[model samples]
Target: MRTAVVSPKGDSKFLLQMRRGGLVKVYDSCLMAGSLYKSLLVSERTTAEEVVQLVLHCYNSSDRGSKYSLYEVCPIKSYERALHSNELPLRIQQNWPSPEHFCLPPQTESGGHT
Candidate 1:
């Protein structure tokens, strides 16, 4: 395994992550809290798609990656939105007025991100 380098500004430098039948949280992206989140380093350049890949890498599985979606979640105001593949994680994070979190939750049965 390789070590992830953190920038002076504390941006995650990028490593990896994933989930099969579970969920993963990149904090400060929403209001939900759980034990699944740790510290994964991703920079301002990291995209929603790239984060999915990192999640898969960190999960050590190439299985059914499409079932997961990166979402900007805010439980307090009941706001949740799926992020575009090309959208920048940090860029979105930097624009939040209140506390929000990023989560790679499994898609709902209707093929929507939950």
Candidate 2:
């Protein structure tokens, strides 16, 4: 397998995350948190960078995690890049698109079964 090796101690400026159905938290030396936040931003109607900063600030100031800095197993820059690309995950994409596009009735209607 391939691997990356840094100095005695690698960069520790990225370590926050929001798990599925779980609260968001920061890590000790993780950077992928930014990516997750970016994904979230894309899902919403907000800018990716704005969302990333909001999440990072929240994790830093909030008492959510165990206080270990919430290091990420991935890099935040990568996450940001992904978000900038406008390539959100399939789950998030589902939230978009009107029901009519899929042949579903409007919410006010009976929502007829297939």
Candidate 3:
């Protein structure tokens, strides 16, 4: 797959949204049954930390980006793993046999989904 770089220094256009199940929601976005997954267009070099920033950007959240955590979730395999701060999501995502998504929860590091 062709890779593209993403950065906070870049504009909002570089920021992508991933809506999987109930983990994320775009404010004022209309509900649609087939809109479960929206592709995230970050490069393989993009770190989990950067992805967190993107998620925060999506929510217009005022909280520190450090307060959130990103996880690679695969409902088909019935598995979810917390990604390291420096990990690359695109790399993990490429390994997915089927559609998967990153989970950004405030307390995932502490075993809390909320």
Best by lDDT: 1
Preferred candidate (lDDT higher): 1 or 2: 1
Ranking by lDDT: 1, 3, 2
Model 1 per-residue lDDT at 100: 33
TM-score of each prediction: 0.58, 0.23, 0.56
- For 1-114, candidate 2 gives per-residue lDDT tens digits of 234444456564444443333122212123332332222222333333333344446446453222222111223232211333222232333453531122110111132211
Where is the poorest 10-residue window by lDDT in model 3? 21-30
Error of 3 at 9 (Å): 24
Superior candidate under TM-score, 1 versus 3: 1
Per-model clash counts, in order, read: 14, 19, 0
Residue range 1-114, candidate 3, lDDT tens digits:
334546765464364444231123111111123334333467667777877777657556676767767766655667767778898776766666654243333333345543
Give all candidates' CA lDDT scores: 0.56, 0.29, 0.54
User: How far in Å is the alpha carbon of 24 misplaced in model 1?
Assistant: 11
Model 3: residues with Cα > 4 Å off, grouped in runs: 1-38, 100-110
Model 2 lDDT-worst window of ten: 99-108
